[model samples]
Target: MPESWFVPTIAAPRRPIGRQVFDFDRQIVVMAIVNRTPDSFFDGGRTYGLESAVAAALAAAEAGAGWVDIGGVPFSPDTPDVAVADEIERVVPVVEAVTAVSDVVVSVDTWRADVAAACLAAGASVVNDTSGLRDPELAAVVAVSEATLVITHSRAEPHVHLRAPRYDDVVTEVRAFLAERIEHAVGLGVPESRIVIDPGHDLNKNTLHSLDLTRRFAEIAALGLPTLAAVSNKDFVGEATGLAKPDRLAPSIAAAAVCALAGARILRMHDVAASVAAATMIECILGFREPAFLAHNV
Candidate 1:
């Protein structure tokens, strides 16, 4: 049987979760992705305006997401060229709109430093760069700013991944990739505490590749930095469990829990409440502080 979600590994990381400091404050953080674009792989064309964007951000915040990632450009590999100005214009207003009413931590998911700078100026607190800082200038933005940077691993563009995905040993390759990135960021004067790492699960990886990384998420967290995993409803879920996108909830939660227990700090999930509840329950169980009562619907 799979180990109880509550019982984290015996050899868990010495540090507390990636987000929580000092290994005591354990509120599981759920970050909902608010993609304000017409071309995201999921939830595209739904939140492209100021009002709808606010609604989406508010909805996630209401659903117990501790943070919201407000994405401007459609985050597709085939996405058309997005001028830095265009991205800035698209998300700044949304950042301003969401920050106006909600105090939830807002994150800007873009590769452009200009957009990141503008959004951070507006109110966003995190820069979720999927490119892993390919722009070279992105590190400067993070270096000069206080916003947290979500640096994930991805080699080439997303859609073209199948064509150019290269890895002799994926685990070693990804670890090296992130190591180099973290080293580079530190060289740019970005503090390690503010860096969050994601292994770029499906960005350019095949089903097997994604599954291996997901199962062994600790390898990413072993770097002693807060790691973020956005493996929600990904192709690997379907490949592993034969469940399509919508039906991948169980597997997605399972992946999140495994990574979290292994020391991943930030979990970027679409189903915020569900994943949070699962992680909390797992934490409760793992700590061995048997509750006053156990409730079960099973």
Candidate 2:
């Protein structure tokens, strides 16, 4: 039987993003992915155009996502290096358009400090640096803007494929990597209240490694900051179930439930509705959330 886990109290104060503040202690946030890159692995650039991207953001907000993460660059190592100007062009408009229409917290997914700054100026509230702080300038930007910073764990440098990355113990290595990055961000003036950690499932890990991280996620959350599980249609899910990307929603949600049970506070998801349902049900089971109508009992 899977061990029943409890949601540990996150004593950190609410993180402010633009005009929005997230109290991870009380809320299990669903951050919907709104990828504007034409080559993003999952979406295949379906929302690459400005209008399509804006519409996608609105749709995610309406579908019950508390946060929307807009990414202009594909994180896949095969993706070409997008110029800072090109990234700014792709992301800032979406951020501005989304922020203008919805009150949802907006996070810009980029490792470049200039692009992050441009997005923040355009109304984004968080910088999701999936490169694990490859550039310290990204941290400085977040510090100066007083915005939220998502420090992810990735062994390879940005846009560089690491062939067959191995670890003695994946969870321990990931935990240590995230800890070091978090400390580095704080030392660079990013506050603890504004920090979030991600194990970067499938970023550099194999399927088994990702499974280990999911099983031992509480160790990552033990850092006392909200941890994000980006388990939406990732390769690990496909590898685990022998399913393709288009057919991995159910398994993805199942993995997300495990992460939630292990005390993950934020879910970075592609399928917003399903992930919201899974996280909500897990929260209710853990007594972190209450049922809305109570029809069956009442």
Candidate 3:
């Protein structure tokens, strides 16, 4: 493995998400993805049902995930817009089920304030807005709920694609966008300690842009907030390695390790067990965690 350089300059030492506390200074948190959408790119609607989504969330918690992100709508522009009521119905039940059984932090992934508010009331502690707050009211919802907010960098509107997205410097632009969004959220009454940033790996960006963001992710981390890396099974990983979505685990893990080494505090992933193992190993290697056994050295 390459020499680990996982030092972080986070603005806060601990981030409270609902009932869970993330000590970013000492750990790399694995936030498992539980998509409630039937047409989601990765799982292909595997966990779309309420029972299945709840099971997946519990399974992820059992597999050592620190958080479970539940999404009711796919971010792909190809999918039709889901009504606010439908979106809330799809995700809130799952959130209620998971939070009732596990202490795992639950995050509702949506760009709509109404959906976010409903999920927060249903026990979601984090609002993972991949749209970069296109609906600014979402910030007020998070602020009122005192929930953590993940400000992702995406240039396009929700469910819309940017025609030929361009950035003079992908990393710099992403960093700036996240900073501005964080300021907006704080202004709406959200605290900086409850904020996180994501560079939004492939959302509105091509393969080259996503790769560039991953290569220089530390710059995003330098913004001094908990940086989230959502690089699991993304198109950029497939494009770079010529592997299809189902076969992208190896490259996905590699990309996640790169991001972790680059100072990412949270990893949003689909394969919970594998991701948890990778994160634990990286933590041990970086001296943040001690090995479980020392039999070989003795």
Q: Best-fitting candidate, measured by TM-score?
A: 3
lDDT of 1 by residue, 1-298 (tens): 3332222222232332223232312445678887777776666567877788888888888887777888877655577766778778778998888887887888899888888888888988888999888876788887887777888898885333356576887877898999999889889888876777889887887888887786677677777666788878877877889986768889999888877776666788988779767767765756633555767863
Worst ten in a row by lDDT for model 3: 1-10
Sort by lDDT, best first: 3, 2, 1
> lDDT of each structure?
0.75, 0.88, 0.90
Show model 2 residue runs off by greater than 4 Å.
1-5
Worst lDDT 10-window in candidate 1: 4-13
lDDT of 2 by residue, 164-196 (tens): 889999999999999898889889999988888
TM-score, prediction 3: 0.97
Write the residue-wise lDDT of candidate 3 on 1-298 in tens digits: 3342446667667777788787887899999999999999998999998899999999999999999999999999999889999999999999999998899999999999999999999888999999998887998888777799999998888888797788899888888888888888888888898898999999999999999988888788888899999999999999999999989998999999999988998999989899999999999988888998899859
Model 1, CA-based lDDT: 0.75
- Rank candidates by TM-score, best first: 3, 2, 1
Cα lDDT of candidate 3 equals 0.90
For all predictions, the C-alpha RMSD in Å is: 4.2, 1.5, 1.6
